[model samples]
Target: MRRTRRDPIVTTVLTLLVGALLAGGWWALRSDPAAPAPAPAQAPPAAQREVTAQHSRQADRPVPRTFDRSAHSTTDPSSTWVIVNKSHPITPSQFRPELSIVRGYQVADPAAGPLTRLLDASDRQGLGFKIASAFRSYGYQDSVHKQLVAAQGEAAADRISARPGHSEHQTGLAVDIVTPADGRCDFEPCFAGTPGGRWLAGNAWRFGFVIRYTPENEERTGYSAEPWHLRYVGPALARELRETGAGSLEEYFGVPGGDYPPVP
Candidate 1:
């Protein structure tokens, strides 16, 4: 009987020792920092391809185009981007643009095709608009300025006529649009509300033109509102001005334009 009891006790002690050895082995595996982690299951090829396509679609979305504001010279007389005002005069003081006749009116050669199309487009809409004046020579502007000064004093002339060298008409890219059906408000503020004027204001940019002066920009342009005056700056620049709400070239280009510097 003692032998049987001793055998049972030895067997139980062996079993406890084996259990401790197994526990130690498990602890060693868990505590080892250099042990390799089990690799995760890979996704199926189809699912991987679907994820890649989704990412490609997102990457393919087009970004909005940014406008480059410095693509042209704002001071070059022949550049479409020229910004002429009271304070900024054409270089050489007598520079004239190459002229081409469009609808019996003279305009810069580059402006002819666009002006012709603009007029034709207006006509298709039944708008009675016509180009009244364009490409006035420096001498002609001088004569006009003197006549204005003679009739209305220097102050009034200054308000209506751009000083001889400073006139945009001399650039050959500026035009005065008028309606023959009603001559009374041809150059008056009331023209802004006319059918043709309203059409030009809304769509001129598409054809490379801008209403150079408005009541909102009179102070900046150093002139009274001239809804009738349209300056050709090419479609790209004109579209930019229209979209940016830039009131005048002076403001858009960040150039000086309030008035002529006091003469010595």
Candidate 2:
């Protein structure tokens, strides 16, 4: 009976010793500096997860569309984007556009409202622009060309004037501006150096107009720099030209210019 009691105590002691050893081993493992940290249980922050998902979704979507270049006909004489140069003459020399009066000058009917707005905006800025010339019929242009030839000789006249059939004025979309009050700066090239000229160069695009014969683009436009000459191509195209840095309609549309086409 004593032997059996002693054996039970021995067994209990052995069990306690084993449990202590196991517990001590676990502690030692946790204290070891080289031991790997347990994987974190908490998920990523909500904002971080959301941003990652957004980036993934954006990458899966197709690229957005770009500006439509074919929004208008570039070849049609009556088109707002028509690129008229020595090479691209209006088909019928006698073609006349519907006209409207804007600031005491005749311009295309489509152009009147924009012209008025342009003038008003400039006037608010205290830079008044007067329209000196607009909308020349083929017959009128013919007479002007003859007079210039008579006064300046044919070669000299060609430098400043477009042949009757090839003139943009015939389309009623071109205007010659002058600052009559800001020092008699009329049709002369010196007008470009004046305050009104500077304003027009920088702000005309906002009103659907461009200085058609610029010193930088004379080669492409087939005319000497005529800073006072403004051509109305509508706001959209004017904006595109300005944004894209296209110096002339010829460069924007890949149209050929710089010379009259050879006679057949």
Candidate 3:
């Protein structure tokens, strides 16, 4: 052993290697078990979380097989129009009071003029028919909503009154007629019960009007039976609707025609 001399370079390298190993061992031994773990990945911000939740809720909702154009029909070409209440109130202004003139009447669309004449003529025939209501503006609808909420509570009023921007009155194509007081008209037996209401239901189509709602089609209209409501679809379509006995414009057109989708 005394006879061998190690190279300085080799001696230095060996010393460095031993020192590194010792240091690493010491470091491992001294490591603390109590060190905190890294924080979990942060969740999305609150706004983003809310948006995600909204999307999830929408996805869970059922899709309508058909389109209900009642609200949009007057404006959307693809939609077919229908009537609302026929006899409960007359004049379009009653349904849309905000647009009423000083005389308390609302203007009718030019297209509705002919239909109105026809309705008037039908009334003279002892049909007990009258224009119950017509074009409604957004403001009138809001007022109606308030009145209905006050009178019937929110839930019940929701069934009868169209929500603002979701009313047929906006379209200028809808009209309600009077049900007869007696049985002398062409109206059905049901119409005699509400004589003016009945007369219009039986004969509205001849004048290019169709009962937009009916008892058989409650599922589509989102309202109870409304025999007096009529919608002017022009003579051609009116005839078709009448022949088909389709209770709702939704059913007649094979689409949904209101705020909600047809019941599943």
Which candidate, 2 or 3, has the higher lDDT?
2
Question: Candidate 3 regions off by >4 Å?
Answer: 1-111, 179-195, 257-264
Expressed as tens digits, the lDDT of each residue in 1-264 for candidate 1 is: 454455878989999999999999888879997777767687545324434544554576565435555666788888778888888888878898899999898899989999999999998998888889999989899999999999998888988788888988888999999999877789999999988889989999999899998999877888888889999988766866876889888898898888778889
> Which candidate has the top score in TM-score?
1
lDDT of 1 at 3: 47
Give the local distance difference test score of model 2. Answer: 0.82
Which model scores highest in lDDT? 1
Native-to-model Cα distance after best TM-score fit, residue 114 in candidate 1, in Å: 0.4
Write candidate 2's Cα lDDT for 175-227 as tens digits. 88887786566788898988889999999998889988888988897888888
Q: Which whole-number lDDT from 0 to 100 does residue 214 have in model 1?
A: 93
Q: Rate the local accuracy (lDDT) of all candidates.
A: 0.84, 0.82, 0.56
* lDDT, residue 162, model 1: 82
- lDDT by residue (tens digit), candidate 3, 1-264: 377889999999999999999999777667956655557698775435444544654576565222222323433421334333221122343343223221133434433555657656765776655454676676878899999999999778877777665666665666655444543432232553564565666766776677666667666666666666666665545655565556665565565444443337
